[model samples]
Target: MASLWSKISAVLPLNEERFPLQFGDRVESSVVEMLKRSRRQLYSDSPSASRTLNAQVILDISWERLNTGTWRHVDKEWRRVYSYGCLFKVAALCRENPSEDEILQAVRTCDMSFLMGAAIMENILQDVVQILQSEIRKSAKDEDDSEHAEVKRIKIASPHVPVIKDQLAVPRIKCPSLESFNTNYLLPLKPVILEGIIDHWPALNKHSWSIEYLRTVAGCRTVPVEVGSRYTDEDWSQTLLTVNEFIDRYILCKDGGKCPGYLAQHQLFDQIPELKEDIRLPDYCCLGEGDEDDITVNAWFGPGGTVSPLHQDPQQNFLAQVVGSKYIRLYSPEDSDKLYPHQSPLLHNTSQVEVENPDAERFPEFAEAPYLECLLRPGDVLFIPVRHWHYVRSLELSFSVSFWWS
Candidate 1:
């Protein structure tokens, strides 16, 4: 077992060339401040809808590499070149036959790989800006003015999210549904499709998902994802079966990293011993008070399968793609009206608005939804907040590991 730094150092050579400072400058401080600002703007506490960046732990490497001397040599001569940068790579380092030592090593070190990488990257950008400012100062007055203006534009041109009110105007909220799951439990949880969820468990990978074999399969429901552009019953059945096969093949490959359908380094076998049980199946559990629960999990199979229409999870969630690729279409909570999620908790139906079709005639308000889209490959995790409506489409056969706990 090796610490996160040990694993990182193993992959990337670190020395004076990379870290000339006896103790590298604390670039993490700047990175954290920026992230905090961004997160605050993205999620402000509200009773109706709450969003926050709860996963604060991230891999931090800024202190490991930062110095003008480290990246000084560009040509033959050593020049003072402050090159600060971050690296983001996700992968399951220890899997399958990982020893106790390996697991212990990884566990002992707080899993901050993701956070560290982001911080390091920020440091690099800041370093570049400082270098530019210094160079501009040394230039002639006219040249300095020109360079300053150019640099200012470049800096300003960096991605800046609009104010929350402007972003809220993107999604058209319309035709509220009559029923929904419940306000106490706003999000979806691992409602295992008794059929697809256990499809990849080594013991049940080939097990029968037939209604007769597992009563749960029959009891489970496929909450209507879309209404107008419906999939033929035959097409839907084939998709689920295919999704099972895709997940089996995906985990079998053991390529633990962000691939087409998942996030980086998202391995579950090492964390949850129950998943390895001989009788592979998902057991439903609740995390909140009384009979009401907020989290649920649904299994998928095939290329066309997807999570329910764009809607926020009742609670915060970290959707870890265990197998296959999924395309995510995201909108802020402010755009809820455009997504048109059912307001009732009893019914799991959203507005039947075709995600591919924006017919302003029927759902005119949807035209406003500002969206950010990305694909989740195996081993990648998607962070979703409460009330942040989002849609998912499977690009390939896939299985997901969804964590939703208040």
Candidate 2:
């Protein structure tokens, strides 16, 4: 087996040759020049002693700008700066004959979303993340000894949850042919519960995703977790935490007084490419009529009772339940008037009326909208048409992956 450093050490040099002193972009010429200087110092024996600190300062400033203020999906120049920061830190650490712990720690602590489409930086993250994954899997050898499985079905946090029954329910179909799905579901813009799909995922059988397994693999990795019950709540806020910290505090919390924490709507796959290997992007995602670049994959992991108050996405969605269950309610785009959408530009896609417990006095029209509901279980996928108003509530400790394509 080749070592991570042996495999990826040449990537930085190639990247340097490819992107030497790009000065005409929005990033100041001085900033690009600083990166060039840092790369040169990286070749020196004592890069960590001085250049690393300077790199960190620039990293902090770029990181602050990237995170604070209005959040945009893309900030080309800032992301490049952030990637430069990560590259410099890792290169310095690797050059110093640092332990594997040091390299893993550096990868976990830094934001993984570097410059988009930059294969050079991805090489840096991919090598470290994959190595950590294999190490964690190797540590689970004892658990797999008797069962012929990597992870046994450990008891989930939630009690046996009754499936939500509905008169108007989403259609359930087993792995329909691509042409059939395009005609019956895609072109018609209808929702369906697709069964017999994703049953063969390695994450389900070969690796078997469980709490203990996820913790072992990514416990130290930091992720943004929502600190309140739901995003619509006045007290709603987000904070950064490691997977272990989130699991202990949120998923296993017994105190009724504490607010629920949700690791919701995060591109966790990009951060932990290890998780991306466990599952496959469904072929149905290709059925969307939008550009291939429009597709976005996100992870939604959290405890029971976490709610996504009536909201609609701009793209078609395939919500796949990996562990535990969820109850989903969806209404057509025609019911937009009844949904009482928030007027603010930031939350304009979200609805003001709560789907389950609507205030009849305030939002009278919401009561009249007929909606289809479904109980999304493990190994199941739910198709949600673009602009369809939907509300989601976790029925138990859950790990779900959603693919959104226009």
Please give each candidate's TM-score: 0.32, 0.84
TM-score of decoy 1 = 0.32
Instruction: Report residue 281 deviation for candidate 2 (angstroms).
Output: 2.3
Q: Count the backbone clashes (under 3 Å) in each candidate.
A: 57, 0
* Clashing pairs for predicted structure model 2, backbone only: none
Position 146, candidate 2: lDDT: 35
lDDT of 1 at 158: 26
Cα lDDT, model 2, residue 294: 73
User: What tens-digit string does per-residue lDDT give for candidate 1 at 205-276?
Assistant: 443322221212211111112211123122332121111223333322234323122221222222122232
- TM-score top scorer: 2
Question: In model 1, where do residues sit more than 4 Å from their true spots?
Answer: 1-298, 305-307, 342-349
Question: How far does residue 307 in candidate 1 sit from its true spot (Å)?
Answer: 5.9
User: Per-prediction RMSD in angstroms?
Assistant: 25.9, 4.2
Candidate 2: tens digits of C-alpha lDDT, residues 187-303 = 889999999889988778777778777876677677888988899898999887888789778876757527599997556777776688899888887776776567788899887
- Poorest lDDT segment (10 consecutive residues) of candidate 1: 76-85
